[model samples]
Target chain A: MTERMQNAADAGPGPHYLALRDHLAGEIAQGALAVGARLPSERQLQLGSGAARGTVREALFQLEAEGLIYRRDRSGWYVSPPPVVYDPTRWAGFMAYVAEQGRVPTTETLGKQSVAASAADAAVFGCAIGTPLFALDRRRAIDGRPVLVERILVDPVIAPDLLDEGLDGSLTAVLTGRYGVRVVRNHVEMRPCALIKDVARALGVASGTPGLLVVRRSFDAGDRIIEYDHEYWRHDAIRVLVEVRTRD
Target chain B: MTERMQNAADAGPGPHYLALRDHLAGEIAQGALAVGARLPSERQLQLGSGAARGTVREALFQLEAEGLIYRRDRSGWYVSPPPVVYDPTRWAGFMAYVAEQGRVPTTETLGKQSVAASAADAAVFGCAIGTPLFALDRRRAIDGRPVLVERILVDPVIAPDLLDEGLDGSLTAVLTGRYGVRVVRNHVEMRPCALIKDVARALGVASGTPGLLVVRRSFDAGDRIIEYDHEYWRHDAIRVLVEVRTRD
Candidate 1:
């Protein structure tokens, strides 16, 4: 090794906080910082990078906020486990997804009842204003982390009184059990949206936090936009996958 | 409006800076803040919101950085137009995209080319490691705003001289120009991704910026993964829409 290389190695780093962040990033890229790797404490980073205590802590906070790392109070920070790449092609439902991951799934229905549709809501739902529709506001959490907030609009003609039933657990299950409505296919549109009003409060992020706006319409055996819903998801909490194929 | 509503509206907001941001956000939501609307100067905002000059400037910087606003040197900040929603499923080729929008399309190669496939990449392209390939990195801007950075891994067996032509313009056009290879269909997977360093820099965002990871496997008339390309796009720069029907 060159004398300069040796000296540089012995000296640890050139810039304190930047150097520590760089090392961690490199480790993550090389899989050295494997998914769920428990990162060293702030004190350890201070020692490792020869930086001030405040600098080390700031770097850690930035990474955690970005979803690259997480903290557990006395337990300190740890590498955030990568989000499971959810393939839309698989067409899995909420219940199936949670079961596969072996996580206890819970739903808190903020409100589940018929509401008069607004003009914008009516147009999207293909109905007129004052049309009684089942509107559900659901907050979904996995392992106690708020992952997504969804507002689902269901057509009443297809599944009557869906709103009246006290919804629990899976959304798909409610449709199937109450009205025998099955989702044979679905179409989705993905867009970028800033959180508004209730969605922001539910996700525990500041109002106007950037989020993924996923507009999905479920179809039955016949083609129709029966269930149109809007999902505002925590960006780090979910990853969507799509597959494209060649046409003959 | 009720007197209570008027008081709520006129009350001195807790934070002057936040109130300004909220006002702009409300205007945008109401369609009153049209795209390219020039915002008031920092002094004007400070006077209007009862905030410090530093606080007002900070807010403008944040808005400009987020693509919600931009500065034209001495001209000050203005609202940016909403980004185009790009549907990879509806069409094929970058050239076609511009043409479809009635915009002029162009290309400019930015970096060197190479050939060597990783195990994962090999599987995606149905090729072997060390397969003759053209690795091209391209930065594409629509109407002068840098929107996407694409890294294309092309199978040289199909078009050996792909490297000879810099991937500045339409890749699909180049493939067709050289080898009768046309992208008749594409399988696209859309997922949320934090940007990599190089891609983030090219897209004018901070490292690990939240963007879209769209992996498209292009195919000709015959079913084949002709080329496997990874496209990184700014979240607001594009949207993905898919239309589906029940399988008979």
Candidate 2:
């Protein structure tokens, strides 16, 4: 442990916890700790580093903050995979993109229900208040780790009996194949957010965990709103990419 | 306090801490607590709610996670302002967008240096390794609160005296006016990140604070990479909006 501390000191100068953090971060960056690899227990780390429990925990927390690792409730810590790159302008659905990125993707339907659109919903959907909408809640996982929870509100007028369809597949594919409704445009808004209780529970994280909130309004050929979606993603799970080309 | 708890209970069924969180969230949502308003001290909140100290803190942590409030070290909590809407596809610079949203914006140049590009920088710039470059670091604030820190690297060959110019203003304006270099296109990538020690100190937040990282490569009329920027934003500071329309 003293020799390891000496190596950490050579890496940089800081508090004891910071040295520990630097050492661990170096190991992760160098792939000594592979992605999805479970970390040693905190007790083990404390014993190995000769640091107090609180110091060891603080170092681990720093690594977590840096998106190098994550914790599951009662399951222990694991190295986080590289974030999936997401281009919002692309039309490829979630399943296709995740698969293209060489990761296994799966979705589970958490809930489905009929809902009455509120005034805010009416404004966004360009429909009258009280309009019936199909609401679907789903949890998506990459490599068997839950990363995002999404709620989709569909205008029942566009896709009748949508709730009866199998929802584990891509909703976009379903809309295009069944209803001939193609999303030609999207208005997306993303921000940093903290997970609420229900969403946190769905993603298997704490309620106050920092997250990324992405809201999308999808439109069809005639520019009519087809679906509105709210996605709550684990903060470390994805990276958004965008490209803008100048018009000639 | 009991009456407040009763009101919270009416809102939802949850633990005492959750009820308290709900009650405060309701107030913020209803505008009873305005943006940028300082929250009551924890002691005051404890006295007012008649909740235990830990319970009060737990509720506050929940609210913080919800992006309703934020804490400054050694300072009490404050109501987080509505995030400034950021459209990466738009050509307008940060100052313009921030002012358009009715908020004050300010920038300060933190450091400037002349450097030799590394292999990674060389690849990004399409220049040879050890090519001379100018690096600039700046901090941007909204309504007197530091919200982002940005590091920009410029191909010095394009603008020989880049480091000598006043950097407190928009670099886009400077590039266009001084070098006749207009940024006609941009490739942007964004992800959730944790602030490292130096950046966190500049933003007055704890090291490893959750943040958003946005990296942009700006191109000129010839499609040459003119500038590369890495921006670290407070996670709660901005919301990104993008509009994508399919070609007819």
Candidate 3:
């Protein structure tokens, strides 16, 4: 056993888990374990630290709670990557921003359908409750890890053939190219929420996992609401940055 | 028993909890149980719903995960209030914003101390490492429930004698009133994180609870970093809104 593991074993049961947690945290902090690297199996961790299986699991749980690591169902734990910086004020598309940050971005179209607008949707769109709305579900990933799931709702009158176009790419580009609609402004609201069942399944996290919900209403030059988007992001996957100057 | 409880009883063990969860969720949605209202005890819920104690607890757990309810240690659960809207681009202070939302706001100064700047702090403040800084810790509440804990770090060179003033009120007012330091701009970064032990304790939540961490660096007209703040908010307490317009 290593000296740190020996020390953890000497510390007895109560503090043993903390020692292990600190040891692994130190490894990640020192870049000994790079981001997205899979951790050893629980049995291996237990054996390596001379700690009980429960103690090893507790240590791993602490690290997960600290946002340093995460577990995939049935899959092993892995170090978490640094959060991607998102600036909604920039009006950049997802592909543009992620690439600018030097990260690989991918989008998968999950499904699409035509749905009647609900009362809340009608209020936002200022249309009849049963107005036809095209709903597109897409999952976005960074470095092969799924990070967010978005449901984009577009009024059918605004983009009649939107469903026929390719959607495994940036919707911003498609809106500008096909519909000649340039998004001029957006009103965004974000809150911490829990992942619903469908979103959790798509993101490969357990239902009820904490998440960040961002709702954006995009408007065209004439102040027409062009698209409404609901984005559910993994709690650790993104950091929101905003710079505000005092109004003159 | 009410018809809803009878329906839950007939739904079998697996779906029984879901029925109860939906019932309570409906109550919360319709405002039958107003925000911040205490929930019935677990035993009471079990007796009322005619379900197993585990089933009642499971339903409550689901609601908590949905951000519709929350627990307060030994205290019983309470209905979660609507999130207070926060617009960082506005130059309003905490008291101003919360009251504008029609919610009561209160602040309590927890403690204060002088600390030397670390490498990261020095980088942000453009000061030498080990420079003296004033650190003020405060907890803010809405409707009698603590929601956030903030640590404000001030450069003593810019706002000397700041520690000697009353901090139970908005620091923005103190900065303008006493120090003649008007914050002209701010850079804010926010992310969902797990609450550390001390912060969780102060907010009366369990350690490692999901939280929203917001870090703001406020600057003066001369572009001097005046105050750097770290705010840890309950995951369900606030919503962030930002309206971005296309640059001309």
Candidate 4:
């Protein structure tokens, strides 16, 4: 072997804190440090790295900066979960995909109310202003982490009793099975949005935290608009996948 | 009219700061506050709203928190541009879309280098590790505001003289015209990501600022993988638009 190769081999993991960082990164990449798994304490890392406490802290800070690990207020550092892949226009429910990936998904209804559609809403839905609409507010979580908060608007005529239907599960399933309105198409738009006001409060994050704002309009088989949804997702919690085929 | 409706109508706007917030929000919604246009100063808003300076500042803070307006350090507040709609898979160029929408689009080549494909990259590209790939770093802007930073990897054999040619302008156009490789399909994935280190530095944003991370793999008509790109977009600058249609 060349002299440089032999020297690198002898040095093995490199500088103190960097070596520790590399070790932790390797573990994360290899799934040894699984998503949502708590990391060792700073003291433990210090011991493992055989570096000074300050050096260990710096390495941890670097990892946090890289988005490989995150810190919660009461909780310590933990391996950041791999982002959940979402297909906004797909007919399948969020629960199905989360479960398919072996992650536990849960939905909770925050509130429900009947409201008069505003002028803007009327324009989008092609209905008169003040048309009665059912608004369902929900918080969705994966593996005990609150990830998304959604406000869904539905045409009351299509699902007259939607407010009382116990919106704790997949609204899509409920719309198909009970209301007989199946979503066959969707127009979806997503942008980065700051989590503010009630949305940040719902997701338990600070106001001004970055979030993905997803707006979707779902159409029934008859081409009637059935639902309008605004979703705010934690920036660190999800990924969206889209496949586009152009030529034959 | 009901007594409550009459009271609201008589009140006109609302409390001092809230009234000011509504007025500004209305202006933004109605496009009176044009994209990239400067917002009125705090002193001007105080004059307009007839509120105290602190109240005016509070209203401005609210608007900034809501992503309707952004401050550029010393440059004062600008009406946050309405998001540019993006379709990651469309094979259309960003320059084309921006120009069509009457916005100026420009690209700057930051740097370029050759990289040896790693094992993971080899698996994704179905190539051997250590194969040469050209890496191009670029920054794209709309209306003179930097919006996206991209790292693009291309197989050297396909576009051998790529580095010799300037890396500015439309990459898709270059590939089609120079290499005779037309993109037929793409696999796209996006997630909320924080702009950090070099990315944040390049975009001139603070570290940990929320952004969109988009990864795409483009394929030619023969299903040959041609390009892999990682893009970081300012969250407030772009929105992804996607349409999905399914049969009954």
Candidate 5:
């Protein structure tokens, strides 16, 4: 049981279990549970709170099912870190997603390559079949939690040198600093989809976990689609708030 | 497996299993799955596919895992129809989501009344805490498959007759038809969320299943926010599509 929960035990029926559960919930709400904190084991909760083992186990089970906690087999239960926040409206990319949400981010650039696109890839990037495209893939994490697998596709005619630049900081920075392209508008489409095999494995979820699919086409100052890309994220990891405004 | 699977079994391995899975997927893709078609049993598929019971079983398992098929304890597996098409962008209310996808719909209103608002409920309707509000709750379906649980909050002054009229077709239709408060614009906020106990039970899924959180505010020709509502859609049950244009 968390310390906060133990404090609540005296006034409640099933005080022991209720106290522990409440305590853990409060800590999580207060952001004090700290990502990856080792939670009390099932047996420890029973002994500390003087509850039946079944009650303690049930409480742990509920938290795990709610995505509030995770277990690593013999490692016991640990608090799940907060989800990554992403805004499709901004062309700021995933690094911004973490920083804007007030979390530190660690980025690993998987690759930056110039490749001829496959038919499916061409269809998405809105380029001719077999056109050269820039593929930049990155894995973004916040508070040590894997959040999104993002792959950006850039049209080579617009930003030929983009493939050579480091993508650790920002895509927008490269477009502006290196290629003199300013992203002015973006068209985004989002849907709920199953995580493909690679994404499931990378995100440490079971295969076929539902995921969010975000496809965005970003425009340059010239009103050209300089970048058209697809990104996937773990569902239930974050909530996307889209405020659609109409002309007055 | 359905009757179609049985007939497909007469075909060779080159086509039987692929054909079986495709046929079912196509039915779903084309919206011809029609909600509650009885799926054949594993034993039945074995007899029909001419493939091993295992092959048919694998296909069934894949579809079930995909939420395209579901089973009742005593009843057989059945097709889960596509989610009723709903969009947060349209001011036409719930019906626009379905009708836009070229599907006909029917509604049975659970209850409708003018309510003196509770603080929480009033905030959703954009009304004062004690102002009269038109509150509606509905059970909506597509092709006989239950797809959405819709709750709407509207200003009572503009929709005084909404409670008197049954809410079967469309909420926006009622507002436009009776009050002349036609929907001219909508502001939508969308997020990925997990179904808690109450929403899960209503949507026929495990509580942990992911959902689409769509909160929308509809505006009339006068640019006033007329109604505020939210909807929860089963992720596996629907696909929302948008045509993305290159920023030209």
Candidate 6:
């Protein structure tokens, strides 16, 4: 429990677990406990709070449920990193922001292929039902922690031999430089989701963990759909940031 | 199981459950099953597919886990609503957008009080410790289904008697009309979250259901923080949209 929480417990009537939970939450918000910092073990917290072991455990579980802390297998609990800010309105790619924040960013191409679009993909791509599209699946990480899985579908006609070119690094840059496809606008949507078996395995989190499902449909100067992207981000690893200004 | 799914099961090499799941998913995506439309009961699906009852149950569970459907108390499964588009960049209110979408919107004031800011709240509001702020707790609905719980913190100094002004209706309208506080810009952050116990009770969902936690810091004409609002939205109810123009 934080000192403030302890004091509140003495002055007020909430339970010990409540006080401890608030205290830890306060510590996290105040930056006294930095992101990705390994928290003291449950035994240590119990000793510090002088609370029962069960109370400490419950408090830790509460923090995890709140998405404030997370645990890796066999490794003890760690304070979650503050969510990285993503502004969908900007044309910037993942590399720009992650590097700007002084964190190492990397992308691993998991799979790449040329596939025939199904009826649904055709509708999304505004092409015939059997048009061939390039599909690129990649895992993105910041500071060696896997945070996002990106599944991108591109118009192969616009960027022929796109799959022959190396698929690593910033795909956005590749789209502009190699493919000559200029992204003019994007329509994005955000949804809360659970990590199903495949995505959960790729992200190294539990199957049912909460996540953010972001779908982006990008258009070129011709207003043609250039890319349809699905990004599954670990809930704790990123924050969606946008500024709204009144249009004059 | 959908007819397409059954057909795919006959033609493809995937498992029975996969075909069924995709069929249902396709139906939802294609708008064959409109948002909030209940799916066929397990018995109906089973009888149609000639699948065992357990297999039918498994497919429904898969859809729910994928965030495609949800069940209400004794009401059976309903197709998750298409997420309402939310553009935080605009100076609009919940009532405006919900109504524009042809859905009825209502706000219920749950609690209101003037409280001294905690250290964290103080920092967000850019005020000294112990500043008096009016906190408004409200639940918002679209078409009579609760979709959001808003916890708003405002500087009472700017809108004294705001509570006495009655805490219902569009808060943005109230700020402009009553207090003359012109909301100039808003910085919003979205995070995937699981509903905690209190919020779960308020939204009538299971405690661990996924949700979107949106934190908006509103600045007035003077560039001072006017409101720090946290809106918890049901995962299926809203999709955030933003348009970012290059500063240049």
Better by TM-score, candidate 5 or 1: 1
Cα DockQ of the candidate 2 complex: 0.40
Per-model DockQ against the true two-chain complex: 0.26, 0.40, 0.37, 0.41, 0.19, 0.45
Using TM-score as the measure, the top candidate is: 6
Error of 3 at B61 (Å): 4.7
* Candidate 2, A1-248: lDDT as tens digits: 12222223244455778888888887888999999899999999999999999899878876786677899788899899988888988877789999999999999998787776755677888888777778888889999989898878899988998999999989988999999998889999998776656677778876656678889999987989988988889988999999987775
Better of 4 and 5 by TM-score: 4
TM for chain B in all models? 0.75, 0.91, 0.88, 0.81, 0.68, 0.85
* Cα shift from native, residue A149, model 5 (Å): 1.1
Residue lDDT tens for model 6, B165-220: 76679888888898888878888888888775567778888777778889999897
Query: What are the per-residue Cα lDDT tens digits for candidate 5 across A1-248?
Result: 11111123222344345556666766776778777798877877778877798778756754654457765546788887766655454445666667888888877787776656655566666777667777777776776677677777788888777767788777777888888887777777676655534566666766555667677777765667777766677764666654444544
Specify the CAPRI tier of model 6: acceptable
Q: Which ten residues in a row have the lowest lDDT in candidate 2 chain A?
A: A1-10
- TM-scores of the candidates in the order shown: 0.71, 0.83, 0.84, 0.85, 0.66, 0.89
Whole-model lDDT per candidate: 0.65, 0.82, 0.82, 0.77, 0.64, 0.78
Between candidates 2 and 5, the one scoring higher on TM-score is 2
**Taking chain A by itself, what TM-score does each prediction score?**
0.74, 0.90, 0.88, 0.79, 0.73, 0.86
How accurate locally is residue B110 in candidate 3, as Cα lDDT from 0 to 100? 84
Interface Cα RMSD of candidate 3: 9.0
lDDT at position B247, candidate 3: 91
**Under CAPRI classification, how is model 5 graded?**
incorrect
Tens-digit lDDT track of model 3 for A188-234 = 99887766456778889876666788899999988999989988898
Question: What lDDT tens digits, residue by residue, belong to model 5 across residues B1-248?
Answer: 11222123222243345566766766765767666788767787777777787667656655664567765545777886655544333334456656776776657665665556655555555666667666676666666655656667787678766778867876776677787876666666665555544556666766656666666777776777787776667766665433333344
- Regions more than 4 Å wrong, model 3: A1-26, A40-63, B1-26, B39-63, B74-76, B127-131
Worst 10 residues of 1 chain A by lDDT: A1-10
lDDT of 2 by residue, B1-248 (tens): 12222223244455778777877887887999889888889999899999999899988976776567888887889889888899887777889999999999999998887766755688898888777788888899999999998888898888889899999988988898999998889999998776655678888876655688889999987889988988889887888998888876
